[model samples]
Target: MTELQSTAFVSEDKFAVAQVALYILAVLQVVAAVMLATGGAPIPFPQQATAMQRLSGTVNAVVMVLAFAVVYCLLARCLRRPTKLVWRIALGTFLTNFGMVVLTMVAQPGPSPVLTGCLCFAGIVSVLRGCKSVKAYSHS
Candidate 1:
């Protein structure tokens, strides 16, 4: 492993923004999983919803649980390897969120797809830059 990969000083400070984003993402995942599991409307929605909607909700809950696995994986990696894993996980989250944003935009039209996409894109870039910076910082 490179020097940065072996160091914590660079990873912790540089990854603060990404860490906050990951925390928010993790909470969102947990809420989504619970909402789906309970067969109720999540925070984004207000009503109890129809049978069809509930069925879809159940399906979404399953997917959300799986997505939350990524959060778990990142957490696990933080214990052993931050430099190598953070950027990859961020990229994965960004791609998955990006697709959801597009679907939400085209299918629902009530939310801001552009804004969501832009934010996700920015988060992904931040994470990548942070990772690169950490690596470079260690070398320097």
Candidate 2:
């Protein structure tokens, strides 16, 4: 078989890996959203806060969650096929989040932070694997 034909087989596997990674990120985002909606520390408000205060907090939390969701969706779309853009986006988002999670772990020293850091690390590895697969398939 020709090189292109051989690459087609490899590319499909890479695409599947990328899709699995995206699904994992999606699940993580959903958990984060639920936490935020139920008063994650990032969106903290006073226990006896006024209605307006609560409303504003909710709005802010929703906006934050949606922003991440949109980015994840965009990355998913890029995974429709192996393009450099997918690699770039996956690298940027996961790496940035991993760094931030590390910072949070250092600052907080809590179990949740440890868990989140682990998850973030997994995400970084998975994205790299997927992108590397894409690169290999592309060059074939």
Candidate 3:
């Protein structure tokens, strides 16, 4: 490979972990959306939940999951040629996900939520570790 291309590849490797995490998050969001649509997702309901309440909860969850999926996909695409702003945004997203996971674990205390929280923590660490490389690439 040409020197320039090789350099680009090396830079890409720096951010690859974050990119993979974003892709995984996007895919998980999509899966959640599908599960919600098919009524297979576990959604909390009040003791006397009416049909309308169940429908409303499912629709809202589906919409939120789909929106987040779109955002994750877009962020992953931006990582192909990450800018400073993209890096900050990605870090912010990872932090936000981690925060939410913490809250979920506190409220629900389940294995599933703990696993999700671990993934979010890993994403945050990956992005932090690649900070210098992303800054260099942005400057270049």
User: What's the lDDT for candidate 3?
Assistant: 0.85
Better of 1 and 2 by TM-score: 2
- For model 3, how does the per-residue alpha-carbon lDDT over 14-87 read when each residue is reduced to its tens digit? 76777788888888899889998897788989889999999998999999999999999899888777788988
By lDDT rank, best first, the candidates go 3, 2, 1
Among these predicted structures, which one has the highest TM-score?
3
Residue 69 in model 1: lDDT:
55
Q: What is the Cα-based lDDT of residue 80 in candidate 1?
A: 37
After superposing candidate 2 on the true structure, give the runs of residues whose Cα lies further than 4 Å from its correct spot.
Answer: 1-11, 15-18, 40-42, 46-50, 130-140
lDDT of 2 by residue, 1-140 (tens): 69999789766655554455556666677778777777764665788999999888787877787677767767867776667776777777767877887888778778766765665566667667776667776888
Residue range 1-140, candidate 1, lDDT tens digits = 58877576555566555555556556656765776677554434447777787677577766868577576546534623355555566667777887898889888775446765665676676666676665765467
| TM-score between candidate 1 and the true structure | 0.56
Local distance difference test, per candidate? 0.63, 0.70, 0.85
Task: Between candidates 1 and 3, name the one with more favorable lDDT.
Answer: 3
TM-score of each: 0.56, 0.66, 0.78
